[model samples]
Target: MIDALHTHRPRIVVIGGGTGLPVILKNLKNRHVDIAAIVTVADDGGSSGILRNYINVVPPGDIRNVMVALSDLPQLELDLFQYRFKSSDQFFAGHAIGNLIIAALSEKRGGIFDAVQILSKMMKVDGHIYPAANEPLELNAEFSDGTQMSGESEITAAGKLIKRVWVETNDDSHKPEAVQQVVDAIMNADQIVLGPGSLFTSILPNLMIENVGDALKRTTADIVYICNIMTQKGETENFTEADHVRVLNQHLGMNFINTVLVNMKEVPPAYIDHKKWNEVSQPVKHDFAGLRAMGCRVISADFLELKDRGAFHNGQEVADELLNLIGRSPDEE
Candidate 1:
């Protein structure tokens, strides 16, 4: 079995958004593994949403980030891809150079996926980046109090308890190509990783796609979840570690995940304050006792670290832990 597994490196499918997914991709790029990043396309804010609305393209912010993370380019080229324009003009201000490039390509090709393919070829990205859906989708959140909110930004800003989330679309504008690619990747993958990002906005939004969720349920891959280090104020205000798993199961169905990765290292109070993070609602401490009851194995490790202005998992450490959990000999495979 080990020899057969070694015949081909494991294929990995990582689903999420924002900085979190990119960080993971950056580390995994160096490994001899096949990777596919299925990014959330529900963003309707900032430059990405602006381009999406004006040009009718999929949000490129997350896609750009993933591309940069997986790019095999020189440091200078990587920096160039990440550069943003600083202008007083509200429209162009804060727009990333990569976003603009993607927007222009979308105009040239007349489709966002086409633009992404072009950019991927140019950057020589180590993995594939795909949008969760082709249609410009509005995220709808139904609160426990019977309140409905539209837009990911508004839902996160509402500070209300979300009972459930669904994509708002009249026609079946889902991208069949992206869906088929994800299904094929999942069917052949050895493992699938689901986020350490915002539960509602970044992670769950991708899984809410009907076909995406269906593929996940049918895939033979072992699913693993990386729990977030800190909770978002309006999103998961007082959620616990177990709460994350429970919520994920609610959408993807029960027994969907096989392993849960949690940060076991103690975070320094100084680092926490420097990052302006309020641990008032600290990470759901890995509910080892409770997780065992749910038939999920809990993998504890010191994967947590402080980076930029927030708490993050040390990419190297995270990769090492995950590789170990999957029984891959880091030195050999």
Candidate 2:
């Protein structure tokens, strides 16, 4: 067994946003690795969209969730932070307490990046959380039919087959940039994890940033993608594991990923409640040969979990796979 005390904490950089990012982080926090999560800022939906439009602040909804995931706060405190105002409450309807706190701090501290840092210290977050970019980004997607749409929500709602997606300023002028810390984290990481989130919206939005993508390509760290178990409607309706990696490679113009963690257990048909799990409604078809052709060291396992009848990753299992990778040298892998 590896001695927890004497061994250096392996530096891990997780790049993605959306619900799945937090699930993995929640599990990883209990382990010894030093984690830094780089979250996408291209969101334009729900409370995040409302807040971003009203204040031009980096959408705090995703960041807030990531913070709570890594926080060592008491259950009651976390509940209070996650509490959302009722729709009947006209002024604060649909706003999470943590979202408001983050937005307020963003204003007081000059940006969301600083707001997250201040909040991290207060919340006793187990790892670093950095927004993919300091400014609000607009996600732009071109459909396989050669038409395009902007905004994360719009791109998904458009529902066409996405040929590719990229990020730009909300105004379509200046290119968004990540802070130095974000770059440094990627460059120095022992392992890099990409998604278990929306392929185009949650994961790629972060990489769409010129510097972040460039850093990912240049980094010597082992790039491991946690492939999602299900296919998302409007985004990845019929995507295979290889298709996911293919799009990622096409976007960055290089196949830098070293490994892929995929689910071996199959999600049962008629098991998913479409009303609740409408976004990602089907199991992702496996393509082992294709993945091998892409030069990925694939680690397939029974990584499925059912919550409220909805399929999700078994976070503990996935984190174990990541930890095992951290233990092995490139030659051994």
Candidate with the greatest lDDT versus the true structure = 2
TM-score of each: 0.92, 0.96
- The pairs that clash in candidate 2 are none
**Clash number by candidate, in order:** 1, 0
- Would you list the C-alpha lDDT of every candidate in the order shown? 0.79, 0.89
Show where candidate 1 strays beyond 4 Å. 89-91, 170-178, 274-281
TM-score of 2: 0.96
Q: Report the alpha-carbon TM-score of model 1 versus the true structure.
A: 0.92
The best candidate by TM-score is 2
Write one digit per residue (lDDT tens) for candidate 2, span 1-333.
245312677888999999999999998886877899999898888888899999989889999999999999999999999999999999999999998999999999888898899899999999999998878888899998999888887888887999999888877778889999999999998899998899999999999899999999999899999998999989998889999999899899988888999999978877888888779768899999998898999999999998887899999888888888877332221
lDDT of 2 at 213: 92
Q: RMSD to the native, candidate 2?
A: 3.0
> In candidate 1, what are the lDDT values of residues 1-333, reduced to their tens digit?
556667787788899997789888888887888888888888888889888778777788999999999998898998988898787766678889899998788778876766777789899998888777655667889998999988888887787898888775524465333457666777778889998688888888888887888888888788888888777777787776788888888887766878888888876655555335542255555567767676778888888887655678887787777777667765654
